[model samples]
Target: MRNLLPLRSALAPTTTVAAFAATAAVTAGFVTAFAAPVAVTAAPAVKLVAADAETNVAAVATDGTTIRYEGLSVRIPAAGEGVQAAAQSTSGDLSITVSRSADGSVVVKTDKHEHSVAQAASASTSRANSAKTCTDSAYQLAGWKLPSFTWYYNPAGTPAALSGTASSAITTATNALSTACGQRALGLATTNGGQTTAVPQVGTTGNCIGNDGRNVIGWVAGNGKWLGMTCTYYKTVNGNKTVTGTDTALNTQYKFFTSTANCSGAYDLQSVVLHERGHSLGLNHVDQTAHASAVMTPALSACSVGKRTLGLGDFQGLVAMYGTK
Candidate 1:
């Protein structure tokens, strides 16, 4: 069973801060499906401190908890969740979910079935045992949905040496979600708010929770094990959870390729953005072992451009949440 817990700002001494909303990041872990293999490493242990009373910083406990900074609230997974845990936190009507990926193996794709990177190692063995199918239709909701929101981009955070059309690629990736689910279902504005110098309120060391009352996407430079993280802020309205704000940060330590034709060992930018956008739009990671074809799966491969497109389960999940077109 999944757990939904409300977190209090460690900075608040007496009163619970309700004005700020929650944040989440969809950290990426990569694997390769081609020939040369990428080394898989474990994510570093998160260290937390109060810093100062005004910092709103808090530590993640053994059972997962909330961390806050002023009006910014974030939820980090416990010790055992690793990168696989899909954590969701609720504070009154506001809630957040952080979806992360784990170190993956090669995802196998055959005529009969496709295996997620997380399950690729065992796929061959399973295939030998019995015929596998790619018909797994499974997805989970984040308990919230955005009726409509216009997001902005921060080109200042773009990698200094990135090639290809980064901005256009990101815009296309963001729109891919609504395209998959149909506009009537997810109603995201076709136009963005343009680029801005303002950065996402997420940090490199701890939880990705921060609420600045804007939907922004940018990059963060760090050695964190995850590829990208999406922080979505939502509040309950009339008994329904509605998204109010969001911020997404892509780790600069890893190399990303916008054009698959130029892709070497780098991960696909559109694929990563597609996955994060799914989280931003209120979709959680389905069991990758069960739904490998899903864009909502927690694992991805280096050149899996196919992920740029949503699977049957991904479409169904969105329709289920926002309603059918």
Candidate 2:
């Protein structure tokens, strides 16, 4: 049953961008590999707190481990042999307490101000449902087939110039996608359908597909809510979901930084492209905020360069779609 999955985004918007039939499934996220356990004596009560005006609030343990969520960072101290005192912030309604679980995992509890507890509970449930919806939608291309793709610096009918940074970024993204799935399904080509389609002009739409069967990659201004998008056109031929073509467009409207040092207020180009390429390879967004560390996570955090590499869930999704070597 090969069907077109709806266009998914890196971030959820107030309104839907495109509509399509829904599918049902559950997916998991990256799990940290714990090393051998070590016994230690009870340490002193520790507390640390920090906040960001724009994106997140965070709290740090005495050892410097941190956890942040919902634009707020609550404070948690290093867990001794047992539970410790709760920490609260003066400015916000956030409070956190730390305790050791039966299985030896550290547990942290958070609470809003007494008045907003009900509202906070409702909002938390809503976010959890949204994340579940995303986790359930780890999409894969039909028949487990991998398609060969080529990139165009210049395609017919448009005049977008490819900067050195952009070109390198695309190459890196393609290579990462290819290597991540352990498949040789993508490559670079000099021409498409015998036509020398020089990289089309920036902001040109609808130039990548039609006539040429090759998948095309380039940049465009993603209007409104999209940071990047991939249109993977596939059809059911002879009971197989065969891909016809794919076109990837990066949002030129957002600031893309080539260098990590300059990544403040912008996204990492390779990270964004790597995610878009996942779409081209028949993988859909893993919308769960808990899996935000996954490469296929629907939305990217500002200045986050972590998605350049595949997480456990991202790799598992690719393997499920394509197969392991």
Candidate 3:
């Protein structure tokens, strides 16, 4: 199911996410991995790529009916397909839909309505390679079903754009985020099975009210000092980290487009969303999931960064929570 929740932002200080899960995500953000090479997608098309050597790639895509994951390719629904494929991509796992505006008009802002999408991924081989397991012993409350996310946008920080590629980018980013905080893939990998789409609800417009956001989105003090806050049911990211996420309205330090910070300016929106969504999924940053460069890494390092795909550690965590895939 491809769903999206809008985000609101604020200029506060230090905070964080749930127990160990949040801790791992937060911590992993610090460790950092080699940045991934950016990939781009043109409008009205679907693209595929398998990492380094793994050929028999498992993929997840929005098939309209449901997000189906299968071998090689995920199932795509026959109707209303290709909505936001690149944006909702399940990190080499799945992608969502992005439709052309009525009259084929191009708007700068992201649209609010959403289209259904199928999730496809390499269930067997892809699981271990695509994701990282959640290992922060802190938020160990397993079996959390489709937890909802509260959206926020910074009040002081008005939307940079509401009707163009910027808005399209925002929608694509959030649609990709649907897979954030994914259910543990259980090594073998599995789908949500039924269309158990976790709907997005309105969040506090002015203030981020959850524990998750406070910590993920770091802030600073007026006297050249740094500050942070803890949050639950919140969204956080470093703009320098990815473009999908905005420059921290409160903290310029936390730029979502961190990958774009250097000469290698590519907006790997899928990867960025993958990391940010991880925070949303309640998984904290981690270095021990599989390898250190995983997207779950404490931070986004330079070239050859995070797995750019899910891995075994991530599946283990999902399997631990949900049953077999």
TM-score of each: 0.60, 0.47, 0.30
Q: What is the TM-score of candidate 1?
A: 0.60
Q: Where does candidate 2 have its weakest 10-residue lDDT segment? A: 116-125
Worst 10 residues of 1 by lDDT: 104-113
Candidate 2 lDDT by residue in tens digits, 147-195: 4455554322222333546666666766675443234332422232322
TM-score computed on alpha carbons, candidate 2: 0.47
Clash totals for all candidate models: 7, 21, 121
Which candidate number has the best TM-score?
A: 1
Give one digit per residue, the lDDT tens place, for model 3 in 141-204. Answer: 1112222333443223212322223223333443443222454323222122221122121121
Candidates ranked by lDDT: 1, 2, 3
The local distance difference test score of each candidate is 0.52, 0.40, 0.26
Judged by whole-model lDDT over C-alpha atoms, candidate 1 comes out at 0.52
Better of 1 and 2 by lDDT: 1
